[model samples]
Target: MREIQTKSTSRVTAQATDIVLRQTDSIRLIFRPTIIDNVKNKEAALKGIFLYQKKSKKAAWEDFETIPLSSVKGGEGYKLEIKTAELLQLFQELTQLYELHQKEGVPRGQKRYVQATPQLEQLASLSDSDIHSFSNANVAVGTSLLSKLLVWATSLDDPSPLIERLVEINPDSLSKLNAALGMQSLKNALASWEENECISDEEFWQESLTKHSFVLEQVFSWPTSIVKGKAYVGGKNVFNQDGNIVDFLLRNRLTQSAALVEIKTPMAPLLGAKYRQTYNVSTELSGSIMQVLNYKHSLQEDFQSLTGRSGDLFDSLNPQCAVIVGNAGSELDDPAKKKAFELYRHQFPGLTVVTFDELFDKTRQLISLLESEPRVEVESDDMPF
Candidate 1:
């Protein structure tokens, strides 16, 4: 939830007319562009991302664009209640396959494929009536089964460990274990264990099946684009003595916010902004310092008319913050990466450029949180939705 305060001098581009949210299983994608191209002196590249969210005063499960990426912690904006009956049928079939593996010792190791078992064949051959019968008898059961199967299929990579353990515990009668009156204890155990456990922590499998990796597919910098210039034309004319008037008064989110932000990787043009006189005065990483300074200056001069309150828009007590974030590899012999921060330190003195390691771990946590709760659905009407 804590972020590098980002002070920007560019207006987000693209005034989207409407947006659509698309989903398949756990993945939700928003199909539209949100970024304003203030960089490169050209129009902003509007790209869309489908991600969960945990951000903001409104906390609306918005169309992703409603909140800043920096604020959308690992929070899935909202969860669509998945169907139950379909999930049940899938779960029953998967359980059968799992039981067969236990009885046959998982055929040594079945990371990808192995000979089909009778249980698997039976499950595959189930008639529509059979699946429907189970669903009709117990709607909850059906939904639970379907949900489990879907989660497992989409999430699991190797079921060897769960299979091997089951097989080891019950010799050839893995499927015919404890049956009380009409309940199956082994089945229940599998249900309780598999449904609640993390796929990565599944010890039944030899190793986790797949890997989840996130790439910084795209990123944008604040203020002047070497190509397009700043968001405001005739840059000087855009500001008054109060700094960033229209943007500050209009952007309550900007005037009353803070974060720890940076620019790294393919850092060529971005670093160019650090050479200005305003930035040269600081001992911190040049880029961030300059950005903050620019943000402050712009707001002070331009925002006065709108807010009718002048002086610093950012709270000096809690004014916006800026930090350089670069890859850990930046610390290596790479001259550009090392030199950027080195100059950063010489200029900013106590400024800290966060390493890629911290960036990665923190981002991963944020992503996970987003995928779950999503911090959507506004909590109050006072906060902008």
Candidate 2:
């Protein structure tokens, strides 16, 4: 490394073209400084920090290969580009340098390392034995390395390295992996319902819809309807009169018309009892329907005020209302009970009533559609002469 010293009118600054701070048998870390244009007044600044690798210890420093670093258009901070191949060795060198710096005291204008994230703290706490055991662990070790590689690879300007690896994977295998992930999500949602069967907390159900607002989309016959922002819109309108908080407020992406949804637990009964010949809608279901209807009325009444405050144009004129409650598959197992429930909902105009199981059943169908392989028809050219 060539040492370059320049004198400025203010003070004298001394630096080297390449100052090796840390080194191993084959690799070395260096501080490269930018040479000043004029020796009179200009002071040289750090151009970059780099890692250089040599084939062997006996190799000349001039012939050392420079590892590529992330290019900063113009920034005060320096980012060293570390590849997966040299990650472990670089990590070891960095840790030792950090320890030495801590003992000596951090230089002026340089910030000392602090454990910010939980991940960094855990990494800092790892001992040599712990690191050895971690590196030797089975597939877990590979998984950790792959995760790091994925993060690094995705951040690159040209991510074709990761893309190439993915392309090498069989298409059928990729499809299967995608299907498995979809099935797992469906199973997780079902498991939540199963665990909280008896719990009738509206907030719990509300939270589920908030996380997976796609469930609300199934209520609308029009495919364009979607939850505008959050599933829950505040109860009160501009006037706050006759204010009733809606569980979910969906809008047609094309028409920009709004829709209201009220959520109830799956355990809520769909039908009460046989009145005359057909079953009557359960009191809980009846109340929820009325509640959603009232919410719609409140929204429509303050349509202009609400729309102005929201800043998004929403057509509150004749907005559709829906009530999602009960589990039809489990509760209305009887053909007669199912027919009565269906007839009532179908006959009800401007309002939709859907069962919990029915809503999730639609979600399952979507997953099935995603998992199903497309049929390719082959055109045969054969003449029967």
Candidate 3:
């Protein structure tokens, strides 16, 4: 995904660690302080912890034991111990619960309940060996696994074990999960756009582009945030001024610089009829570029007044423009025509000329990265069970 420059001066913070495990005759698990600080409620984090075990590598996990953490000792790091056999049993139960949750669809919310069969008090016992093994798994996957456990625990009559584990989850884990889900949604949206049988009209393109301005930013490499759709370049409600509204207005989050955007339907032409046996920029393409430039000029002229009223949100100097129009269809089928289009696009310094197909291709490539890139992992010297 393209990186957008943020306005904030501080550096990005690292995600917090949740749980670390070590294995020997007994399994030892350590919970980081950040987890306890981020739970939905204090009770959920303070309750006794559950130990789930898997019978075999190939078998599912079943409920094993629940251990209260009130007696556990550590200021920043809390430790819990469980016999190896009991830990394995608990892991097996967790795996079974995870599988069942997956089949039923993970539930969302914070309702309290207790399980009838597992019987929270039946056993109060237990607790990794591959420190790097756990580290190798993607952070996104770990978060998903944790979420499944939460869902499974919540479904039972007594959710204390799972609820307690929730306290061990770092708040940053939720941020990672949200990002993963957002990327998945963008991929699905792009796939749906590709699968549509009929091409969208100009109005539809404009509306969709406004809603998904990130797609526009990706294609143009603008690296800015969308400030407003159908922005009034001539200043608020000044309809009498020429070029009163620009399709979109973008602002650099850090610099507060502005850019103007204009949209045209994908069916618009990339190349017109040959002139002197050579392809040239189609009228539609030229017109859109000129339109964006005109909007840029309008914004630049009104910059002082606009920024005065909005508080330095629009930079008067060095305003940029971009026009998203046309599709590289049959007209640009030949390599020569495609090269001509590229050369034409390069002629503009402050203005960018991009095709709808180019935007779609960029989005598709971004979606592909989600699968190709490995999930982010963190390494620690902490013991493994």
TM-scores of the candidates are 0.24, 0.55, 0.52
- Candidate 3: regions farther than 4 A off: 1-168, 171-176, 196-200, 235-243, 373-385
Compared with the true structure, all predictions reach lDDT values of 0.38, 0.67, 0.62
Ranking 2 against 3 by TM-score, winner: 2
lDDT of 1 by residue, 1-385 (tens): 1111112223443232212244444444332323344356432233333344444554444544455546655754544343465445434434433343345322332123344568667766888799899689999988797778758765766665566656566554544443231133223433432353333232221111111111111111222111111223112543543322111111123443322233333122223333433223122235455655565555444444423563343332232333433334433344554565455455543233444344344444544454465457757659566
Candidate 3, residues 92-161, lDDT tens digits: the string is 5444333333332222332222243443233222113343355357677656756875687667875665
Residue 102, candidate 1: alpha-carbon lDDT: 40
TM-score of 1: 0.24
In model 1, the worst 10-residue window by lDDT is 209-218
lDDT of 2 by residue, 1-385 (tens): 1222322222222222344555788777665442223345332222334645455788766644543345435554565665564556545544443343334322222222233467756965898688777777756875687578668787876565458878998999899977776677766776666567567787788888666666667788885455543333435646845355677778888888888888888889989889887899899988998888887877777677666776475677788988989988778877889888988888768998988877877877776776689999998898778
Cα miss at 227, model 3 (Å)? Answer: 0.4
Highest lDDT against the true fold, candidate: 2
Candidates sorted on lDDT, descending: 2, 3, 1
Clash totals for all candidate models? 63, 1, 33
Which ten contiguous residues of candidate 3 have the minimum total lDDT?
1-10
**TM-score ranking of the models:** 2, 3, 1
